[model samples]
Target: MMESYLELKKRHQKEVNEFPFGFAFSPAQFVEMMRKWGLDYEKDINKIVSIGNGGYVQKKDRDNMHEMFSRHRKEIRDFISADESGEEFVYKMFLREMRNYGYGWTGDPKDTLEALGLTWEDVQNNEKLLNGFNKASEVALRKVI
Candidate 1:
């Protein structure tokens, strides 16, 4: 059986409340967390939870995940913007790509760039468009957190 949101939350209570920091879970770590949560990842590789990979998640869970991310949009954006590596723009672009696909990272961010008739250079040159992309990546990001 699939794990419920409550169970996921209860299991990773610390990570959930202090997301994007403190423990600082990576996307890969997120998948591993789900695996440890009781999902048969090895037996059902197709149903594995991963960002930018064709992993299957139940519609109800997807909806809930979307809602949660929507609620924390500002916080997520702020956190990414706070990066000091001077690569915050690229990070934002990645999130923008995720936003293009129901706020989920179903594939490479470059795919979204292509879909929009853009090249990486185009994105690099267009600050306004990048700012316009909705900050929705927190959907897939904060899934287990």
Candidate 2:
């Protein structure tokens, strides 16, 4: 079943609200957290996640992840600003994609992923084209909280 916006927010809040400071974490732990919360992860094959690699999310890896996240965030924001109706356009396209992907009858975020033909791998590969939808989902998800 698809997770509700409230449910996602609740989970996100639960995890981040009390995140420990100065507590070191391995990439595996972070991946586990994401999985527990139904988040898509592109870090599956990382050596650190496997415990056989460096065993921690190394500084370089952490920096790379931050860079990737920033890039996607900027693209989404840019898309939303490029057109006066940019936000509206993403929502419209999200709805259309949902319908096209056979979720025409529902408004679910999981369905949104499916509608856009996105797996985490797909998102990783085609983020420029689809991150706006992802960003829109994040905005909507956060707003509900």
Candidate 3:
């Protein structure tokens, strides 16, 4: 009974896909949610669209989606606290996403990294983005001193 993100967005007239501070929901989060809802992650991926945008979910799945969001709120909150810098959080999540789901960016998808205003090279060479990546990495590695 999870609602498609688009449905929820239209209903609320707000963007609810990303965490309030930064970071999109992690793939692990989505996998856990699917498990909770007794959904097959592989077979039911279409049920999720906000991950990278596009598509819609069946109205029947609305309640389950709401339940998942309600339960996962804490995880998002934790991510905000840990990320500190919103852009770093967003980059880390986006990198995780790119690794988990092949972007298939060849089709000119509207939601590809390039379409989203970034690139792997940008992360590597752009001073601002690279610094964010380095900071996030240091935190991930527990190298903060």
* Residue 60 lDDT (model 2): 33
Instruction: Report the error of model 2 at residue 118, Å.
Output: 17
In the predicted model 3, the residue pairs found to clash are: 1-61, 1-62, 1-63, 1-64, 2-61, 2-62, 2-64, 2-65, 3-62
lDDT of 3 at 64: 59
**TM-scores for the candidates:** 0.25, 0.31, 0.26
Tell me the spans in candidate 1 whose CA falls farther than 4 Å from its real position. Answer: 1-103, 134-145
Worst 10 residues of 1 by lDDT: 15-24
Q: Name model 3 segments beyond 4 Å from true.
A: 1-65, 86-89, 103-145
In candidate 3, what are the lDDT values of residues 21-134, reduced to their tens digit? 112266776566667656677997665444234223434555655666664554433443455454555445544434333433322222435533556676666555566545
Q: Which lDDT tens digits does candidate 2 get at residues 1-145?
A: 4333344335545644443211226767666654654444575434333223333343335555556546644544454345354345444455445545544334365766764435656545644435546655555555445
- In model 1, the Cα lDDT at residue 61 comes to 53
Off by over 4 Å in 2: 1-59, 87-93, 96-102, 107-145
What does each candidate score in C-alpha RMSD? 15.6, 16.2, 14.9
lDDT of each: 0.46, 0.47, 0.47
lDDT of 2: 0.47
How much does candidate 3 score in TM-score? Answer: 0.26
